[model samples]
Target chain A: MRLARLPWWAIIIVAGLAIVFYSFFTSPLYRRALIFVTDDPRLTTTRFANVIYDVRTDEGGIRRVEGVFVGQRGDILNVETSRQVTIRVPRADIAALSCEPPASEGDCPVDATITLLRAQISGFLIFEDMGRFRIVTDDGERQEVRKFDVIIDAVQRTPENCPPSPEARCRVVLPLNPEREANQLSGTVLEANADDFLIELAPEVIVPVRQSDIVAVVRYTPAECALNNLVGCDSGIFLTLFVAVIAFALAVVIGLVAGLMRISDNPILYNAATVYVEVLRGVPLLVTLLFVNFALYVWLRDEFPKIAPTLQLIIAALALIVALSQAWSKRALLKSEPSSFWQPIVAAAIMGTTLVAVTGLFAANSDLPPLSRGILGLAICYGAYLAELFRAGIQSIGRGQMEAARSLGMSYLQAMRYIILPQAFRVVLPPLGNEFIAMLKDTALLTVIALPEMTQRARIFAADTFRVFEPYITIGALYLCMTLLLSVLVRAAERRLALPR
Target chain B: MAETPIILVQNVSKHFRTPRGVVHALRNVSLEVYPREVITIIGPSGSGKSTLLRCINRLETFDSGAIIVDGIALDTAANINRVRAEVGMVFQSFNLFPNYTALENICLAQRVVRKRSRKEAIEIARALLAKVGIPEKADAYPGQLSGGQQQRVAIARALAMQPKIMLFDEPTSALDPEMIKEVLDVMLQLAAEGMTMLVVSHEMGFARAAASRAIFMDQGEIVEQGDPQTLFTAPQSERMKIFLSKIIKH
Candidate 1:
């Protein structure tokens, strides 16, 4: 009993907050920022100069000097050190020279933190006149370093306010070659030439990249999404629920109306409902969805415009028929009673106006959005099944119940509302819960229309990551958990509402 | 004899179309009951006694003739609800609403058709439940109550509409032997109060004890009708004799 008294709402609130917090911190923007700050030093590190010169001392031993290579003046080589001093070295004493910045060590000093990329030759300054730089690496492989090879330069941040003179040391990022990070650039190649390929980096921005550089080429099919927000966070679940809940709501309305019509005493109403049920039920749900999305929507967009005016004319003709019927039916009374002459005409005019409005509303919106089409397809398809279910539930009650209510002098509609529907609702509850679960799962089929529901998101994840089994298995587990939870809730509701027989 | 008849059925006939064939359930059945008169109808199986009672309230529409209750014709669509409200019916199986309690079952029609407020309906229902001798069982559902209690509740439900005439169609036939006396006791009290009643029953003891007139019916037609004592003692027709002989032995 004490455990039962525990505040379950508090626990749910805390759990919900935890999920939202986790979703927020791990969002793509924050993840990308974290990567920029923590990636390999070649991408973020900065230095004043990245030059190293190895020369022989007067004692016949070799010593190395690191600085920015200023220039060569005839017999002396000029270099600027981190201490802001220019030093001259006789060209004759020079043994080996390398432009690659040395790693942090006791002998090699750097003004700021910096890291260098590995190449046969590395140098701080490349001679643009020659269009190349020469440096000796630790491996001693003499390779040419071209100016065009360095794609991105150092990135700098704004200088923060410092004391005294207001000058501040700004943090700078190091330049890196584009080839090393080509694996991260996953997109389609827009245009390619011998020297470079024009690649679409994002939807709106395209950049020219060297042909020799490694690039991740990703080919996209028409069905696949290039960018979709519903796949992010836990929005896929929300999207699925949105479709299922809306479709279920619409289906309930349709099912109630059709179910009542199916059981009607009138042949016209019954036949209309029967035809609707037979046609919708005979077609598979997937085919219905495809027909709604592709065939119906396409026709509505392209062909419905031409037919809408004809539909209006047909509706007007039908309204005229209804008016004529009304007038003809009351002709004898009208002829006998002159004061009631305008009654049938007024009634017909009102009914005809209402009919036109109802039919004209549909003709007004020739094209429906994709999401609406998907929801409509699900609703109408399941509505037929639910209509049968509702009919069965209503029929399950004995005839005596109706008679008893009727004998009480209650109108037929009142008796149905007060007696029959309440009992029928009880009888159909468990089946209704089952339909909801089935419909929830059926929402996955809408991925054919490129809806970013849970299953669709999983498909996209599998295609992007090339790990086919993991994403699908995860989605299956999620669906299992959701359905199991829904089942428990429904059983609880049933228990709560149960009455002794 | 001076009072106007509260219910008049004139040449009323009903035919049911079954998959087997069309069968005449009621053939030119006619009856009249004055205000405060208690009439009990006795019949063999398929005698059309129940059909005649149902037609009086238009629960089952007749193929010909007319039924007028409390001077209101049953043929008029607008008058049907009014006539039904004036005439109450109790079924053989005590078709009490299982979804409602005994009190609510009585209150439903009063609140809906009579447009009584909830409090007023509840007050009237409580008074009627007490009158039926099941005041303590008012909160119990029909399913939970015994057949006698359910029948009493059905009587209270019918009386809650303040109807002018009451129609009983084998009201005690579904009850146990012990339970039948309790239901019959309520009907006897109603008879003593001089309520206009039409009862279809096989209980000759009740007919002999309370009915102002006893009728014998067979083959969808009334065979005999007379004072209860005279009709029970000296039957006029062979059909009546055979029916009485067969029923009286039980």
Candidate 2:
């Protein structure tokens, strides 16, 4: 019989690549390139662009006309006048520029526009003049020849320009500094106003700012004195490091208890472990962070007026520890148990309940301290998963082994220690490695609580500059690298621990 | 020559609480085993031969009995482990620890129960393995060996404990036909060495060759007891005659 399907991994990889590619191409700067190609014909013919625009480089240096675009054939199309000059091009030499409706009107026109516009511009724009064009389109259908406004939108000069469109209107070079011409831009704090602010630029543009679009308003306040307190730096670094260390230590302790409890013959201990795992694993880390910040903090503050902050941290850690331990122990127990039909279902149910409870509690509190709470939350969540790894390792020994040991006059504990556990642990190492990597990724969940882990640091960096997408991409790549490294480490460990052949 | 028997059983009876209700496995069985005498118990399946042997080591508790081994009563927990140590038992399945090498299997009881030093235990294990005719296989795990080799290892393991009496509970029952002779040879050698052995087996030829006295059991009670040659040549009881006829024909 013919095979019924595509390989599942291939499908998943293709889907993931598609998503990453889509996100990259649909970003704002990328969208600008698509618009450039659709509006300027000179960019299409020359396949090059020399765009003079201000850019903030890595060292925070502001440079004007930082880059120039050269075509594959050494042609250079200046960004200025490229759009207007496109009107003079003959139909035969126009190459191609096409405009298509956005996939979703409510959503931004990044993917559909770029994909369609790139196909139209590729044939006409030699590889060189691709960087000069600046294209603009709007929600409304009306098309008119207007001077390009480069200042209103911060434009960065890069060697690469967007591909052209089928309509020969691929590149549009907006005039620089229209605001400077009109004398409307201002950087100085002339007035203290909460709703509006003005910033002066060398080459500015006049653009109407809508109230709905503005997210933040700030007034500049500068202090003349530079204090070398060093206290702030110490406390910030210390606090972050402290949370990470404490969370890991607490996770180890709680994991042991939970693991033991989960395997205990007593119904109460087992059920409690089950409940703990479910509640912890069920909730989203963000919600857990919020609960710790808001409700937990308030409750503790009320309960202990003088030591409320200390108690809040303690309580959050304890809650996280309990949650993590519960999760770990239950997982360990399930892993240790013989392969029975109900084992996985029972484990899943417990995990689900714990996660849901944790998320609910976290959501209720939004004002908790970020780093400590986030670390604690992640520790608790992954502790359960780790516990199962331990359990699986311990339980992999055969029953016959125990029986044989006992028959040889050895006690149960002795048999387990000498004959069974060593073998079982060897079997469990690979999965344990996987759990460690998973736990590392789970550290990102702390971002919800405002702990400035790598991802959170990236977020702060994004917010400081308005380049949000790059920071996120950097964070994603970092996470991928760390996880991949961990995977390699685990594989190495597996090989080391593996039984002979 | 009339020293009191080393082991004595008086009106011993055992009942098993199985899933199918109570089974009266042994009924008013009585026997005496003298020092350095080989007594072989021959019976069909469910004849309580193993239960009787296990009772001596207290591996199986008798419902009603007074068993005396080496002047110590067998019912008390105080002496159970001690009695088990003194009376080494070998099972049909060999029950050797699969993970351990044959030498380790032999030395385990010696080191753990007897508290022998590792060096002493190893020496004893090597000697016992050699006695069982597979000394070269002492370093092999049970899984790495054949059924006959494992059984030999099991015999060596039991012998390494240095028990006063050895109990063989169908030691050759689980072996392949070709492997059975090797295990039987070991037992025969043990018998020749004058080990006070209580053996439960179906091997009529081994019983004739090695046993000083042979007992036939049926329905949890001994039906006949005699010299092996007389029992085989001319059975006294109708049950004995019938049993012999059936087994001999097979």
Candidate 3:
């Protein structure tokens, strides 16, 4: 009903966000991109592709080459261009090769031009005809502008000499062609090295320059090259959603079962559920998450096999029997209670999944991936809270309903399934929605385990860019959008499910 | 009538443990109802009349002795459901499931416990609704119906199982003055049709008209019992006289 008062624009915005979130979460391409962005750079084998080389020549100029690194010979580094031609450069000439996208400010480069020395005028630099010296510009007026001419140990540019664009970095005078004399033939520098380099004097006319130029090579890769292309932070949003949804689902199941056990008359089940609720709820979610990720997983990995075989057999047998019995019982009521027919199947599936997960613990050589461990921790912690919700919901029904149900010859389980649980489900739905939204927001805590969820991605981005407010604010907004979308959906569902008053 | 008793309650004693102390709810209560015979039990609050009816279907477990409904013993846990199926009960508050319609309330037990087909259950439910004189109210929920109509629906829900014996625990006590007759009329009709019944109520006029035997209970024990004609006219015990005076005078 509160949603009814919302303006049309607000509704449209929420709906649009819902569609966008749904599309991103469902798209495999997006998922793969997210993986590429979020995966550890050191472990990724594809990080070397699409490399840009900054080679310093014997002349004190830096030449930018965009290429893939082919195999290297004794002292020659083979760099293949987009046109499939491999250029061999001495290893000493290659100043730096970077695969990361350019970040803001200092680490990136500004434009410059280079002037060749007169020493190699005729013998090797025959392309520069009748010139005492040739000058080459590294900025891409002659080609696509994709390279950054990184300058090191250069004079800082003042505000008066800044470029037309006038950025914070534009203040520095580029070190590429630092000096331009009275008579020098300026060409387009294509590729350069310490031995011999190519310079384009005109269109389609490239010639080589020899090592004996009147310049010295001096350049170093910047100390702090930020991996500031934080597109991967978007992947973190999807990851958080995935963790929240899966953990919420797992928590619901755990809560339902544990809630039933808590209310049941059987002492063992009751006490076990009581202990689980007390212990899980008493501990902080972060502590539980960390313990599960760091401590519990290690213990489970080592000790799981010892108990798996026997527990596996017992559970398997129990699952089979429960499935068979439920099927047998449901056959008669199938026409009347069609939905109830799925109860046994769901029960069997839960049991089967538990068995598989336990066995997987034995089969796995290492702890579960951080994402899975985080999800597990979230599920366990939230399950206790949800169990309390379920218990309160169940208990909210009066004693007379149970008595009336029982008086009709219905078994305890039958009464609960047909009568109590349906009502309880309705009662608990609103709180369940709240819990889901809470869990979605709580996924931010999983950053400690390095789960690569949205918050984690944002943290990494913040750390990399050294800008705290931007990443955190962006991630916070994303979380709010998701939670709002979820709230609207839940409200819609509640309205639909509301009993005829 | 020398026919076999449909329900036999023998020395059934029950107690409830409270934070205060153990309260004896039923102290060695015993009774029997022959087929087609209607018995009415009158008692004060906590006199064990409702507990006796509840124990008949094993809703309330007895501390001592045994209960047999239509020859099935209540001592065994396995027989509880079977025994319940054979014995139907109506509560004072008319506990018709709020989630269900009048028809669904009647059909639920039949389709579930009786393993009747949905169509069969619906058919039976419709007939019972008609029999209870509220055929038009079948689709209505308990909340939509009046107190008298709800109680009638509760009766129909119990009868949907085609139980051999019916128990009523102060069925008309919760109804308003203007509504009590509708429910009593239904019970009287059931009595006329010879459905074996054991009702606990202070409705003396209905008891006098429909009951074959009348019982008076006090302090968790049956004080007096006889044919309704003699019991209503002249009670034997001092406790029965005092209880009859307290209820009848008002």
Candidate 4:
């Protein structure tokens, strides 16, 4: 039995779907596996005896604790302090827990702090004295009690040094008795209010104090999260569309100049136009774009301060105009009267100047609302190519037609306008349509300067989700669909304008 | 007798630039054509016949001479187009605008050079086409018509301008042997109506039947000049004798 062959795009789609399905299924599995393996008791028990881990406190100004677990139950543990004090807890007495990897794994050992403020430890704790406490664990039939020595790691001399208000993960150092010694106690504030602060004393112990006793206060600010979001969401689209519009506008101007110059009888104008076209056409579009944005923009910024961002637009317009005008002017100049050389150039100049001035004014005034740059850029770029097409179409008419017109007392201009241009324009329609289609595709270049076009929006979406592939794929599809639609429109126009055989 | 002639030539000479230095196409030649007189010029190839005819309309300027056509001198640029409009020309190739129909081709000169209204030009073109006996073919493009028909259209196009004098440059040369008769007949009819025409042709029968005056040219100079009947029967120059005998024998 033979299987049906899938189209390439279908294959790509299937592969993409498979990848998505696999990733979707595997994501949760990976997360669960990560949690379970890291929390495994086999590693924690072995590493917990020799290594003392500290969960820094907020009140003692991020003090480090050193302890070892000696006794264990479902929710209870006996932890021996660095001075050999063992603390025990009942099954339901533990409030919080965390795990860390062993030191030998090239990473610091995990330190976990458990706060017992919410737990009902009063039922299970044995108070030996004012400064000592113990915990009892019930192991079903037997009660295992562990007793160990107790000593103050460091006695705080002045309790007034603690911070008044504590934020998340903030620490405060307190001097319990400054008259007696210079000893200090470090504690992380577990909770805080305007008048009172709660801090973790040990793994499960928490102490509270009034804010009036404290002498210091500190605040930690969270990292600004909106900047990255803004850059990704807003700036990306804005810059791209901006650049594309500028480039397109420049292209139109270049087309007009080169088109008119090509037809000019003056060697200076014609040669300059030819050179411009040659240079632009020879260079890669990416190179030209970069050169305009980086080099030309920098050079012209001082001289033309009013048109800074629009410098790229100017350069793009100039480059495209040069390329397009050269081709058009050459074709037009060869076939048309010398006076006609000004038509495309004048039209393009007007369009370019108007577009540039408007865009510059808007850009200066902070009114680049949306997609205006992209539209302008596309118009400019395509206009140049169109002018050339017009020239070529005009030239395609036979010389006999011109001579006939002249013989009838029609001046050269009259003959070209009435007899030659009409026929030539019919011939040029197909190629002109092609140029328009190209222009539509080239609009994607707008992303460089942060215009909020479709592609830029997609990028922002991707960055937010940290899933880079999907958004780009979707964007690519959107662009392709748009370009295809434009191509279809151009083809329809070409057909409508096509001359009958 | 002292009054200026309708057309006057004073020692008119023409030289052409060529790769082999200046060619003396016409040399100190002079002639006058009165109003409404049919003048036929007969010459062998390279005898300055067509050049002389073109000079009369100022289409070909002479190097050193004065040609006064209908009262205005040909030397001035100011009167060139005006002169051309008055002295309409029919080319050997029938240089009609191929893109236009016969009627449009005829009407264009009338409307453009003469500044006539389109309606008036069209009416004049139609009448002229009828005069040439090809009114039915007025709507046909030049390319669609035969050589004889196109030549007749060319004649009609020139006449539409309402020129006083018509210069024919070997009008029948490019036509077929049978088609030549049609164009010659039109010329003969024009001549009988006392139209001032300068025609360069080798058609002996046309000269004899329609030409009031026949001038024979050899070596860029007039070899003999007289009435067509007298010129054909007895020539003054040996060159004319040889040329006429050769033509008649053929």
Candidate 5:
């Protein structure tokens, strides 16, 4: 009786959650750890944390030491070694600190504040805080993000061996298949726009490729792309799978209900379903996500920042509550020894985690998490398509079923429930399963909104490691595994429910 | 037979708009069936036999004409369902709800339309199953049943509705030769029990034994109609002779 009453998988899930929380919240780096760097993290020292230093000793050889950063005493910088021993460094002897160029006196204050803030958060990289670049001149640093054109124009480097002014010597790459080599033009870039691109391959020879034709603007060197690369946090496949499953679940419910409405006799219901299907179908998913994630999200934040995130949090919290409680319910959770006592705390923790995630979403100036935007976008889009599939499935049932039901006095809705949909579902299951696999792949599109799903997350790792092939190969295998697994599941379901011969 | 007709048809014509052209399936057909009349309709393919049967229950609406079943006029979509409920139909392909057990097939409409409780519906289903001589197969799905058994289940499903009239559109035509007997036996029992029925079948034996009247149709029109014995023995239209000679040889 006790065994039967015990909730299945509840203990395992709870234990898993506990381990995850421990690994994440404690000092141990959970899979992917985010680290952010300021423009020049040089001479300025504020909040002391671990730092690697290249120090020139009196013997004239450089020595590397890991130590805590201490504030500068005049021209001599103070430092504490890992051995608890204090050390002093004159400005001339201090060769390098944290791989950053020496910051001017004016830059030190901002750098100090950033370093202090970073230390306070235990070195976690909030997406918004990451990759923030600002131009700092001797006069006074402008308090704004550097635009692309400005950076391209101003930062011509002597070491890069490029022309001192204006045109950038770059390698322009065009999209190419594996069968062909990548089309690259090593030339001086003259001008580029949405429509046209002009590159001077040689002084006399100018090659023009359409912007639409270009695959990528290859950087001078394969270096760290902070926007696309990260060392650790999550392989982030779960984010993709989670959003896909949730969106698909939502889509199924919406599809079936709305699909029935389309064929229903009532004009209001029929017209409403028809309009929903037509409008949603017409609007491209990419456009919808972009609008919802950026424009819509920004407007909401600007107009009602407090209310927007609050309302979002409430919705997220309630959803989490429902989901977690349902999952935990198998344990007879509230009725169990720890439950009634531990329930509120667990509930709070769930809410807190979700809230943190939501906050992080906006922290990147993305307004909402890319996953949230992806889910809504995919669900609505797929729901429209599925509605059509469902309509066709329902129609495929023999007219005699309806006739049989109607002749026996069953109303249209009743006939559908009892006789029609069950048959339609049987016919539709295979296609619906195919749609699910398709949806799993489509989750990759959510990366446009910058969700750190597999493709987006792997690209981030690839940019960081400068190993494009390995990350891309891993991504391909992951997607293949997911789709294959989904196919197998669908087949198994079909087999289990196969009609007797 | 009752003085008042239980099923009435007057100048019913139906045309289907196909991609090729509009095909007139039923042309100015007129027929009346009194209470407890077992009328058998036999015709070549595309002769409007099944189309006419469908028209009675308003499953296939006539382009023009009037069909009154159980005194209710099948004139408007609003009243069509009510009229349909009084007329039960069995199809050539059985058209049994594939996902449901034979028992559930019988009970579904009874519970939904008649507001019968689960227990009452089950009881009615079981009784109809027994009447159809397949009570043991009540729990079996249509897919699991033989063609003959499926047709019987379809009959039982219709019977459970307690409809005033039953229409069968070539019920045994899709069945194997050996399976035809089981379905015909159930129809014979229904005819003996005096259920008003309209059947379209090629089986002249069943027509002669059970039908009060036999109708011969060709080119979307009734070629001839009479008592089955007279219709079969006496010479009438050329179409009737050709149809009967073709069917009766078997």
Candidate 6:
């Protein structure tokens, strides 16, 4: 084709490239090559574009500029006066053109220093010397100016320096189920620290409070400069994403194991799977959910707290190590030399012990609300469904495939890893896509346990505004769009898989 | 006869315990296949021809029998993987892993089972694909290939492991009549290269042209055994004669 007959898109792209090239060459990073350094003061007034900077002769002095420039010639400054005369001044007579004056003005007699309180101070402040403060004024100057000069423009208030007395009555809230008659501790603010404070109900009863109690400390009597700010409704998305991500990731692994157990030849595996399916799969998801949130999780945090979960992690580590070694070891357990085989085992034992020991150091009350407990509960619930999906996908593969793999001397795990599972994944793609959508919706149920997901977040807004129609409609549309996006992704994957290798 | 048998099947019998009754798939089926010998078993369906071949690779478990392949006793040891590694089997349906490319199907078993490095496995797979005369189809998925091409890939997949013996259970039976020749031709090439093979098929021409020994089976038992020339031209048993006559009529 002739260059003039090129496609519209090609012409457009070439035009865009030319524009980009011009912009790139003219950019500030390449300014040295393009920009002319001028000291000519009279060049300020121009038909040709130029910059005029008004600079202070001395520090703390104002410099100003005048007029939309009319014209300039041969370094002569034509100043357009407000009275209408275009006053011309010779460039030789002008001093210097600059943006700002050099430095701070005269010092305050050597003994004066200041702590600048520029913006509004947030939260409470402890015992700090409040003298000779430097601040940024509305006029946009950072200086240690006279305080009495600004006192007329500010609300002068008396300062309270004394700590709250032991007899000072207050209410304390702990981290627990808000519905239950728990977490409410009535006390007095005894003393304050950098992060937390000591509170006392009576003279001899004092309790140390940690910041993560997510507390709001109130005084019985108001102070001189008391501040109360309303922090808005936040059903944080990070918290929701955290729960969904952990739940889904764990569920996939759990599903794989349970599905394998169902297909295993051992009677123990078969019986274990039967029990898992009958009890967890048969029971209502709500029952297990509530029980974990209200009962078990509470007990772990409040009663036997640290011991139970730490022990479980230790056991989990041990089981994982054992399973990995048994499945993938290159050497036969009996035939291999002890030093070669036992090294990994010893290392794993040491690691597991260290894990247990590390967990012991922190008296971590799983202060996690149902937000986290719901993650655990949901993973267990969905894992069962995914297992059945996995089993169906696995079983649908031709028996000849397994025979072919095994005839190649591959172990059961090897065959499953290399051959069977990869094929099964292809077969189960549409169903797995559906499961992801189901999982996204299931996260909404977490709100029943008082954890906020998207629906719960919208509900809060709806409740506050008393406008159900708009919020729900907006949320429904958002959810449908998200699901449609997921569908698009799944369809793309299907199309990719359908392509010839 | 001086060289040890590549495959020795002794008194092998297998029965299926279906809901209806115990259907005997194999009954006292014994045979020896020597090194570089190509043996073909011809019979009608349900005559234990496929069962007897599958037993050598322990793909089917026998009720009472012994199958020794490459000096490793099958079913008598915990690790049948050793026996499996030396003996490769190709199926009638091709049984190529649908997820993998023709080259990947060949490379997978070599990497996973034989523990060949990726580069080494790919090199061998490409060679085998070339040997099967579809060198350009190395990157094509099994689903993208024709029946003959897919079967050739399956044969190459089996060959990639460098098995001591190759089992073909009606390899050409599932192919289109036109496509059957391509698969049979590859098998004939493998035979010419002195690969020990045991095939079960009703392809009289393949049996006559390629096989060193021919066996006839019926009612889950071997009815007649001899050279391809002796069996095809002059049958010994009444069942063999009737089976040949029926096949010839078709």
Clashes of each: 3, 63, 5, 66, 7, 1
lDDT of 2 by residue, A1-501 (tens): 123474777467546655655754656433333222112112123223333444344465644432222222223222222221111111222222332343442222322221111101112221122234323332212123222322424433232354443233334333344333321221222221232211112222222222332233222121111123122222222333445456656665566557756775545557787787777768876676667666665664454344444544554554455555545555533322222223334444554455455444544453455554566666776666656655556666656465445445554556667677767767766776676666666666566666655556666655643456665654564456557667868888887765331
Docking class of 1: acceptable
Residue pairs in clash, model 5: A7-A330, A32-A232, A32-A233, A33-A232, A228-A460, A229-A460, A230-A460
Better structure of 1 and 4 per DockQ:
1
Give every collision pair in model 3. A113-A177, A135-A185, A135-A186, A157-A171, A236-A454
Off by over 4 Å in 6: A1-234, A278-368, A428-430, A499-501, B1-4, B75-82, B111-123
Candidate 1 whole-model C-alpha lDDT, 0 to 1? 0.70
- Candidate 4 lDDT, A275-340, residue by residue in tens: 766666666555555555555444444445565565747654774565466457555343323334
TM-score-wise, the better of 1 and 4 is 1
Q: With candidate 5 superimposed using the best TM-score fit, by how many Å does residue B138's alpha carbon deviate from the native?
A: 1.3
* DockQ top scorer: 6
Q: Which residue pairs does candidate 1 place in steric collision?
A: A99-A122, A99-A123, A100-A122
Ranked candidates (lDDT, high to low): 3, 1, 5, 6, 2, 4
Q: Which stretches of candidate 2 lie over 4 Å from their true place?
A: A1-417, A420-501, B10-20, B23-30, B41-52, B60-66, B75-78, B214-250
TM-score of chain B of each: 0.97, 0.96, 0.96, 0.96, 0.96, 0.96
DockQ of each: 0.25, 0.12, 0.26, 0.07, 0.23, 0.44
Question: B1-250 in candidate 2: lDDT tens per residue?
Answer: 4988889999999887899999889999998889988888987788889889878876666778789988788654445556666787788777776556889888876777678999999998888888889889877778789898888888787777787888888888888899899988999999999899988988988998999999999889999997899988988889878877887865
Native-structure RMSD, model 2: 17.6
What's the lDDT for residue B102 in model 5? 89
Every candidate's fraction of true contacts kept comes to 0.47, 0.12, 0.47, 0.09, 0.62, 0.59
- Model 3 regions more than 4 Å off: A1-4, A7-175, A178-234, A266-268, A295-366, A466-469, B16-22, B75-80, B229-233
| Candidate with more favorable, higher DockQ: 3 or 4 | 3
Candidate 6: fraction of native contacts reproduced = 0.59
**Candidate 3 residue-wise lDDT, A163-191, digit = tens:** 32201223222233223341133344456
How close is candidate 5 at the interface, in terms of C-alpha RMSD after superposing the true interface residues? 13.9
Scored by lDDT, model 6 comes in at 0.64
Query: Which stretches of model 1 miss by more than 4 angstroms?
Result: A1-235, A312-362, B16-21, B242-249
lDDT of 5 by residue, A1-501 (tens): 265564778456445545544544452223232121111122333324334556555565655544444345545544445322111112221222231233543122211211100000011111112233232212222222222212223333333533211111221111112221111223333443332223343443112222333233332121122223221123266566777899999899779867876876445457778999999889987787777777876675566555556767775666466445544543433332233335444544664576567555554454555556678778888999899999889889988787777777776667778788877878899889999998898888877877767778776765654445445555665576568678879998888767665
- Candidate 1's residue-wise lDDT over B76-150, tens digit each? 556887888998999998888777888999999999899999999999999999999999998898878999999
Off by over 4 Å in 4: A1-501, B1-5, B11-29, B39-63, B75-78, B172-178, B200-250
